[model samples]
Target: MHDSIFIKSLFNTLYFVFIGTPFVIAFQLATALILNIEVKGINIFRTLYYLPYLVPMVASVIIWIIIFGHTGVVNQILGLVGLGPFDWIQNVHLIKPVIIAMGMWAAGSGILIFLAGLKGVPTHLYEVAKIDGAGPIKRFIHVTLPMITPTILFSVVMQSIAYFQMFTESYILNKGGPDYASTTYLVNTYNTAFRDFDFGLAMAQSWILFIIILIITLIVMRSSKSWVYYEAGNGR
Candidate 1:
């Protein structure tokens, strides 16, 4: 029973990270790119985009609960499109995706880090690429992406770590419910320690989770040699 629960929680955590990390990174990078533009009032735009990140986690989850609730604005919008009064939190299949969507809502920190990376990329590189008849897409693929590889690696590692330990959303919104669909490793550990009063078992579970994260992160670091670039050279 314990092993089964452990494996299920582990799978849940990995599924959450695998599915959510891409969207989080994509949204953050897109926002960073947009904010990097030197439009008037750009600072205000940055602040507005970052507002959700500033909200407390419990509060933010509550807000999501309201927004994705049966009568929430999301369903209302869907109704206009002739769909959904869907129970986002209650549906077993949709629960994890809803949680992932919630994670993406607070992508401000990632955006800011990526925006810094974008700023640090040498303008001359883009100019040189343009001179070689590189269009915007090619310049982005060859110049911008390679230059920002470090940032991508950083975001991947950090976001993976964060998602692996995801707790607040499961605890608050789903209560690790709807058939334990949202029960991540941390949530399982929390229940083991607090609900079951099994400190030793919980500690064992935590150590296993730590080892799992360490292994995965090391793998990502090792794999970075193929892609992650530094100012000096490729990461090797």
Candidate 2:
């Protein structure tokens, strides 16, 4: 029984990670790339993009719930477009997309990290690429990507950790209802501990999450030496 419960919780955690991490990473990387370009009012845009990250998690989730509710802004917009009201959080097929959308709203930290990495990339490397007739695409492939691999890996690890603990949105928005569509591992563990008073199982689940995170982090670190480049004379 204990082993079965552990396996179930592990599967749930992995499910959340798989569903969420790609969206977070892709959105952050896109935002970072856009912000890295030379443009007017970039700082203002960056601040706006990052504003959601500053909002408390509970408050953010509440705000999203209001926006995605049946009579909320989203349905209202759909009505304006002559479409019937649709349930967002309550729809099993839409719940994951809704969560991914919400997660994208708080991707500012990752964008900022990537931007910093972009800035630190040696200008001379780009110049060398240009001298060798490398176009923007080539430059990005040979110079930008290799230099930013560390930042990308770091953001992936951090976001994976965050997504593994996702519970607030599901709890506040749908309470993991609609046939357990948004029943993340963290929510399940919380329900087990508080609602069911299964303290021992909760404790075991928590340790399992901790061990999973530790193992993944160690794997990332072990793999980093091969591709993550540090500047010469700077031991990072």
TM-score of 2: 0.89
lDDT of 1 at 96: 89
Quote model 1's TM-score: 0.96
Candidate 2 lDDT tens digits, 134-160: 999999999988888878888878988
Runs of candidate 1 exceeding 4 Å displacement: 233-236
Cα lDDT tens digits for candidate 1, 89-160:
999899988888887888888999999999999999998998999998998899999889999999999999
Model 1 weakest 10-residue run by lDDT: 227-236
Clashing pairs in 2: none
What TM-scores do the predictions have? 0.96, 0.89
**Model 2 alpha-carbon drift over 4 Å, by segment:** 1-12, 82-84, 233-236
- Report lDDT (Cα) of residue 62, candidate 2: 91
lDDT of each: 0.90, 0.82
